[model samples]
Target: MSDINISKLDAASADFDRKLQKLLAWNEADDRHIQQTVLDIIADVRTKGDKAVIDYTNRFDQRHISAAGELELPGEILKSAWESLPAEQAQALQIAAKRIRAYAERQKIESWQYTEVDGTLLGQKITPLDRAGLYVPGGKAAYPSSVLMNAVPAKVAGVGELIMVVPAPKGETNQLVLAAAYLAGVDRAFAVGGAQAIAALAYGTETIPAVAKIVGPGNIYVATAKKFVFGRVGIDMIAGPSEILIICDGGTNADWIAMDLFSQAEHDENAQAILISQDESFLKAVEQSIHKLLPQMERARIISASLSARGALIKVNNLNEAVDIANIIAPEHLELSVEDPEILGKNIRHAGAIFMGRYTAEVIGDYCAGPNHVLPTSGTARFSSPLGVYDFQKRSSLINCSQTGAETLGKTASLLARGESLTAHARSAEYRLKA
Candidate 1:
């Protein structure tokens, strides 16, 4: 929002990264203190079951549900929600489901068993987790996109059952999200949300069965709870605030660039929006555009705070440096607003999903980018990947061997087993060889 010079802006950008690095230097989610904490929650939920879940829901949600059965949303409500939605809205959800389902089907891995050397056979049989729980945020922000993104993949992966949970913030859930859930083929859905829903999903209640995995986006408490319950049941990732990075050339329109940055900034106060450019004049124009465009937004105060705090306009040494920095940051979303988006795209290695050209804004990725908007954030992109059909599927190794093959395989196995000093393993292999 300020008309700062390039030098000051760069210094500010450097400071932001330095502070961010310090804040996240240690991944405390894995620290022993926190590690045992999640385990305790999982244990309490697992053993006490419905009572513990109700206690947690009351304690965390600050709402009084009469009992455990009250947590699960009724099928009629979801069905009514589906029927009540505008025909166009319903159709749109169906269309999104179609695209996601088709894509997810293509991503699905079939059960394969193949013969290998020595006549031994080994392959992988891909199957879906029996049950999955999806958490959709509620209140002013209800993401229908999340339903399609999280459920369709699991559906395509052949998951036997899909359950969704969303906070009925203000004592009510959004019909749009519920409609989307129906379209996505969810087996069950509930009004219970927040950490309590996650706890219930990880550890079943009397009414709601525990799920094999949990996916979708939520607030900090939900995210922290997901981190806690991870080992008990699978979770997509430890998600953080949303972010978007753009590398722009001098040729693009400055107004478009500013609004694009605002799109991500408006997501949350903590969300980040950054622009790196080789041309200094273009960067200044973009900054000016951001200032001019600030007043036009209904959420001007929020956007300005985000821009001033987390957003930046950086002057890079060259396009190469921009790409290198982009990879290092490993942003959740990266856009090349440059002349040749494809050229810059090749240099990128660490990003959840990339958008080429100024026209492909990060907002598109949020709604219709055809990629899971549920991406790893807070630099987790370095190791984690975006949510996909693979997240919902489990792969099991297949091994079959003829008697001759077993004898030959066992001989090699015995030698390696002895090297590791596993006596039982060595004896087993030797016995197989002799047999």
Candidate 2:
């Protein structure tokens, strides 16, 4: 507890913005080595296809495979994994999947067209991508929740196929992930990972089919690979460290707030957890609660490091000030732990996911809360959104001009084209113009 040192900040501080900037700043440097390595891997996969994926999987993941055929897990394997789970685990997975599916069902977009006054039709055609690739981090980092979050929404969007790639380091696989693939209706899965898996998905291999888009979280190498392959394939987003910002009115249990901070901090040393409050005494109480409860946490060391390095206990003038700061920070997870959260939530403009009221813990949103846990991080909530069914679906502008409408539109197009000095465009439109 003595070594646990979380920063304390006041909204009235003279250098508050500077201190906040220092705290929130995450250095995302593009290392030449990593980019070059990813490029080489992409080139290899592009040229050699399945052989490259096999070779990299064997070398990086400590596997011995004579053929790429062994890389893909059969549908029977996924089914068997789901069936082999204990009753309790299976029930929990099903519950979470059901809730996620139900939430996603409401987000499905429908194509619609409307006739204009001039007998012209204008609307949008909504269509789902043919295939989407999901990358799940393997080893100890494997998250069954990630599989459910990414796969369920894509399935709900009516994507033709959901392909999954998970790295099974040292030939070890997690049954929970496989079971999730089964429950979430993953069409195919491969036990290959890192930059190689991303390249294979983006460009296609003999064994693994190419996908239109890729989604899910990964390590730095995987993130870089996603960045490199963006134009070739659609990606969810370049995710950053997980974060949580809580606004409390000194009413909720100090212990609960402290534990909530620990929840995100325990994710990793770089993860951030911040608490904002109007009551100075409540801030002190929460700090004491953090000191008292952190020792009992399983990931105490990690939480301590994260809190000490990035965590903050902020004292604001009032709850409104707290929301102002939250909007500026644009945290991935924002909790309004106040008496009336709905009122405060109205003022909140930016947040990946908002947890309302004292009873709503941010952890619930990560699991079965019926909203996407795959949210934009690193202040991306200011513009980006949570991964949803809409991500898998695309919109194409629809335009059906009647003969009368064409004549009028073509004349305008001809005038505009000629003004831009494009003779071919002008002539093409002029040809359609009637007299």
Q: Best by lDDT, which number? A: 2
For candidate 2, list the clashing residue pairs, or say none.
Answer: none
Model 2 spans with C-alpha error above 4 angstroms: none
TM-score of each: 0.90, 0.99
Encode model 1's per-residue lDDT on 45-142: one tens digit a residue. Answer: 77887777676666666668877778777788888889999988888778777876776777777788888766788999888899999889887787
Error of 1 at 141 (Å): 2.5
Model 2, 1-435: lDDT tens digits are: 347899999999999999999999998786999899999999999999999998998899999988988999889999999999999999999999999999999999999999978899999999999999999999988699999999999999999999999999988999999999999999999999999999999999999999999999999999999999999999999998899999999999999999999999999999999999999999999999998898898999999999999999999999999999999999999999999999999999999999999999999999898999999899999999999999999999999998888888999998999899998998997787777
Error of 1 at 50 (Å): 2.4
Residue pairs in collision within model 1: none
